[model samples]
Target: METKIFAKDQIDEAVALLREGELVAFPTETVYGLGAIATKEESVKNVYKAKGRPSDNPLIVTVSDEKMVERYAKSVPDRAKKLIKHFWPGPLTILLFVKEGSLPTAVTGGLKTVAFRCPDDKLTHDLIAKLGYPIVGPSANTSTKPSPTTAQHVYHDLRGKIAGIIDGGETRVGLESTIVDLSVETPIVLRPGEITPEEISEVLGEEVLINTGKVSDKEIPKAPGMKYRHYAPSAPVVVVDDVNDFAKIDFNDHIGVMALEDELDKIDLPKANKFNLGRNLVDADHNLFSGLRYFDDKKDITQIYVQGFNEGQASLAYMNRLNKAAGGHHF
Candidate 1:
């Protein structure tokens, strides 16, 4: 099925579908979001069904600005406000307590709070402004699948499932937004994305707590994509402790190596697929999924090997996605 492209001219129709409790994939700086009206429980369920996402994993609502966030959430912490001033309209999402029954319970997964962000794109901003309602939006992909960076990726993952897709070309960040929970006095990093925790601290003057372990089955989360196995591919991928460690392992022919510039030239394996993630982590972050998609597409690749980076601001988000994709397949 051919995917419909909705530009600014056709935004009215998109808004109409949303108002009618229909699903639509729209652009954001981080990625395309498959959205449904947050107040409409039945409509919000369609987002989960369309992407095959789990009901327990809550959805983030996309708004126009901080003022709009106030409508759904009860209070925005001072730290949250500071962070918003620094990263709003970008790849950062703040989690706060919701007004009692302000939004549908489905949007919060029966939790007391919700995640909200004011998108940066002109089309998205205008759509949110015109709709006058919050939209439950998660990355436009199936559960455990790589997040879509381009409109084609969205169509590839959710073409017939959604009513429409706004093709705003490729996303700028090429990753999901940085999710921080401010419901407590101190902020916690529920999910790392393009924005770093250090950057958040610099703006708020407080340390950020990052959640790494899997959440318990009984526990509830305020933000979306918190505990899911995200950005995974069909092929089995592994992340080694380092490039030198990868050299110790031997595979006959169906192996691929993804690495940085320092390790790229050092490792020499014959007739094996190899991808250089660039000299630094920034380029690696941008190209990581594209490289995985390329390798996953190849019929000959049985397993892909990766080299892990040191823990730091530049490597945090990139490593988070890589580690999830690897799932302890590392050598």
Candidate 2:
């Protein structure tokens, strides 16, 4: 279980490991992904077992380019094509109907549709290009853990459990990809990410539905990051909706406060170790998990309080991560 750091130049070794049914945690534009050959059943099952993830939680398949989508995916809907044209090699995952027996059943969670995306990172793109096939990747951490944004985060959670990690660098988006279901009549967004719904709506010239709720027993989970209470850190987390409420609430001296840059001064706890996420929503999305991890590392801090954003497309994914990190406690 000695995890090696496959530096950028060493991706060929990473590809070799993937081909041999060993898991490799590699960087993506969105986050570091625990990758295995999408077509290999043993490899895909190892991905789930490594993270202790539920078999029902689906994994997204990463392709080298757009054309490769057709090999595993039955067909890409018009709206998906338009979105991929604009956002491919970026952080958008499109759920398309899967070709029967083309992928390992573990990769799809026994579902008919497969989640696919082309990562923007050169190291990732080149790695997949060399492999010449799809790699099924979920976030490279234990199940329900904060998605790994850096190679160290991957190491922190999965060092001895996985085969190796490709240390391309810290992830750019620092969140999961925006996931949309294109197999159905009207496209539905099962998970929000860096790509906002408004942007998707404008491209398709039609409304995109957001369905981030939990799935039913009778229904299958359409995508990853949808059914689980994911992104939780090791500390106790609470979400404060209003920055103004910071002045009214009482906090201990050892508490760690995660707040927007504009509202850092608003938190009245004199001894609170404040971490500024950023002035706007975009910064919030980028720094949310890192901020949570920051607080988790501080043993002196007992409770970690976070500032929540008002509902909007820009803050949609930010809120989703924060809500889960806070364990659904938002006030």
Candidate 3:
């Protein structure tokens, strides 16, 4: 029930805690993850409870390397193998045909497929490798809130609810891993991240479909950040095609606008507190979640207006997070 930062030298103790079925919030290259040994159902349950996540909302398991993939996945198709060869130990997560009894039901959410990634973080890889099993760790934050990119965010949301955090400092990508579904014949990208669809297609030497359609009510979430309002801050975010139009509105609550660097001069909201997203789309991706959380901390701001970025191969992940946070609404 106690919460504190664990130094790098303490990974062995963290591994011991995981092996004993306790949850440990740790860093990954993409984001901080609340981890537990994939084989332990009770451990996975604690993870779900800590994040206030639904049991049916599956968890992505982290492995040390591609060699450990087969231990959890039943069939790694040619496409998956090519993807692993190209993007493993990085930000890509591939959903595969889960090996029978390879993982507990809690990890897979009763689905026949399982999503797994080999993170680029040394501490995370060492923890997984030392434990001798895959560890199921989703973003270490409360469900539907901004996904924590730093250990401080984890400590804020999950301090007294679970175990200690292994502060590996800030995550590099600052977004969750790109998730691809390989269970079917043609791979479909379930969630966009740093690894774009074009990159995946180039790696496999074939076109991969990007599933950008609306998720229906009856559909189950194949990955995290889907099937829920996610990456949201305490303030409600509204996406607008142009920030100039927002100048026309008169609202009672304090207004906050996230303005793109190039278009900052065009925005005419005199009273709005503006946050700049750099001209480079990559920088926008880097600052997206943290920017949202920044606005959330502005106590008087109830409505946050975000300048929408056109979704493309490079900007897919940034747009995806914004779309979910605003429920795909464009004002």
Top of the candidates by TM-score: 2
Lowest summed lDDT across 10 adjacent residues in model 1 is found at 264-273
**CA lDDT of each prediction against the hidden true structure:** 0.81, 0.85, 0.84
User: Whose lDDT is higher: candidate 1's or candidate 2's?
Assistant: 2
Q: Per-residue CA lDDT of candidate 3, range 1-331, in tens?
A: 8876789999998888888888899898888999888898988999988888977788998899888888788877788888888887899999998999989999988889999899999998888889899888798889988888888889889989867799998888888889998887788899999999899988988779998776566776777766767888878888877656666656454887776776666665553467777787777787777778777778888888887777568878888889888877778
lDDT of 3: 0.84
RMSD after CA superposition, every candidate: 2.2, 1.7, 2.1
Winning candidate number (lDDT): 2
Off by over 4 Å in 1: 1-3, 261-272
Q: How close is candidate 2 to the true structure, as a TM-score?
A: 0.95
lDDT of 2 by residue, 173-285 (tens): 88898998888777788888889888988899988899856777666687987776788877778898988888866777788888888788766566338888888877888
Q: Return the candidate ranking by TM-score, descending.
A: 2, 3, 1
Residue 168's C-alpha lDDT in candidate 3?
Answer: 94
Pairs with backbone N, CA or C atoms under 3 Å apart (clashes), candidate 3: none
Instruction: Please provide, for model 1 over 111-215, each residue's C-alpha lDDT reduced to its tens digit, 9 standing for 90 to 100.
Output: 888888887898888887899987887988877888887888888888778888887887777777889888876678888988888888888888888877677
